[model samples]
Each structure stands twice: as C-alpha cells, then as structure tokens.
Target: MSLEVLAVDDSRTMRDMIRFALEPAGFTVHTAEDGVHGTEVLDAIDPDVIITDINMPRMDGFGFIDAVRDRGQYKATPILVLTTEAAPEMKMRARNAGATGWIVKPFDPVKLVKALQMVAG
Candidate 1:
C-alpha cells in the first residue's frame, strides 16, 4: 500500500518542502497549518505517519502529539518531530510525549527522505 503521511507546520514553505521530498519517495502527503488543523486532518485522513514542527501558531507540535496520544486510535501511531529546535530538552520532551523520532530543521532533503522512509516504512 502507498504510505500516507501528514505533515504539520505553520509555514507553507516547509510543508511544501516536505511534500516535494516525500512525494517522490512514494508517500501520499497531506498538510496542516498547525496543531488544530493537524488534528482535523488526522480525523479526516487517519494517515499512516505524521511529521510535525515544534513551533506553530495554533496549538504547537507538543500539543498536537499530546492530543494524538490521548486518543486511543492514534496512541500507537508513528510521529516524527521535524523542527528547527535541536535542544536536548526538546528532544527529551518529544520522546516522552510519544514521538517516534526527532529531526532538526535545515535538514538535508536526501537524508530527510531516507529517515522518513525508515520511520514510515
């Protein structure tokens, strides 16, 4: 089956970038402007994987993850935090909050695709 991925970020450019990279990797990507929007997409799509940013206008990535984890249907889903924040504490919080992995922004597109493939597959 084709992989379905939800990419959540406030920046349109960032969402486009992820879609550009991952679409070629055989993923069907859907985007959300922020956590609230992301939650809506989750309900509509039930995507196989989620990639999100830390800072967003409406509920942040942490809140997004928390909401997903709180829901029984999404509790075991794979989530990857793709953000500009690379601090150890940020990674720790993401890990504790149920994210499967964390990736720093300004990331190499090739590497990012590979990592997403590894995680989403």
Candidate 2:
C-alpha cells in the first residue's frame, strides 16, 4: 500500500529531498516548514508516518512529537526523527517525547524508503 507522509523541516532543500526520495517510491509526501506549520498541515491530512528534523526556528522536533502524540487519532502514528544530531541523549529524548524511530542526516534514499516502509507497515 502507498503511504502518506508528512515531512517537517526548516530547510527547503531537505523538504525537497524528502519529496524526491519518497515520491518515486510510491509514497505521497507532504511538507511543512517547522513544528507549528507541521501541526497546521497535520490538521488537514492524516499521514501514515511523520518525518521531522530536530532543530527548527519556531518549534522543534520534540515539541512537534509531543503535539502529535497529544492528538488522540495521531497518537499511534509513527514519528521518525531525521536530523544530523546523533547524540545518544538526543535519541533518548526523542523516545521520551514519543518518537517511533530516528535516522541521521544525509540519509540514503533507498534506506530512507526502507525505513519508512518498515515503520509504517
């Protein structure tokens, strides 16, 4: 089945890259600028998985995860943190905040697609 994804990041390039990586893989990709925008987009679509970056201008990934978890319908939605930060503590923090998985930045397109399929399935 094709998955619907929401990718939240501050960098335009990262969003475009996510779109490029997922779209041809048979996933429908939606993008947002930051946590606030991500929540706004979330209001409109119920994505199968949410991919967010750690650092952002308005609200960060942790906050975004919290917000997503608070929503009753989205509580079970898989949230994957995709960022350059690979600190152990950061991963734990994301886990505490309700993230389903984590991936380091400059991700391989094939691996990313595989990860998303693994998590969302």
Q: What is the C-alpha lDDT of each candidate?
A: 0.90, 0.97
Candidate 2, residue 100: lDDT: 94
* TM accuracy, model 2: 0.99
Candidate 1 similarity to native, TM-score? 0.95
Clashes of each: 0, 0
Question: Model 1, 20: alpha-carbon shift in Å?
Answer: 0.4
Q: Write the per-residue lDDT of candidate 2 for residues 1-121, one digit (tens) a residue.
A: 8899999999999999999999999999999999999999999999999999999988999999999999999989999999999999999999999999999999999999999999999
- Write one digit per residue (lDDT tens) for candidate 1, span 30-112: 99999999999888898888999999987999999999899898887899999999899999999999999988888788997
Q: Model 1: runs farther than 4 Å from truth?
A: none
| Residue pairs that clash (backbone atoms under 3 angstroms), model 2 | none
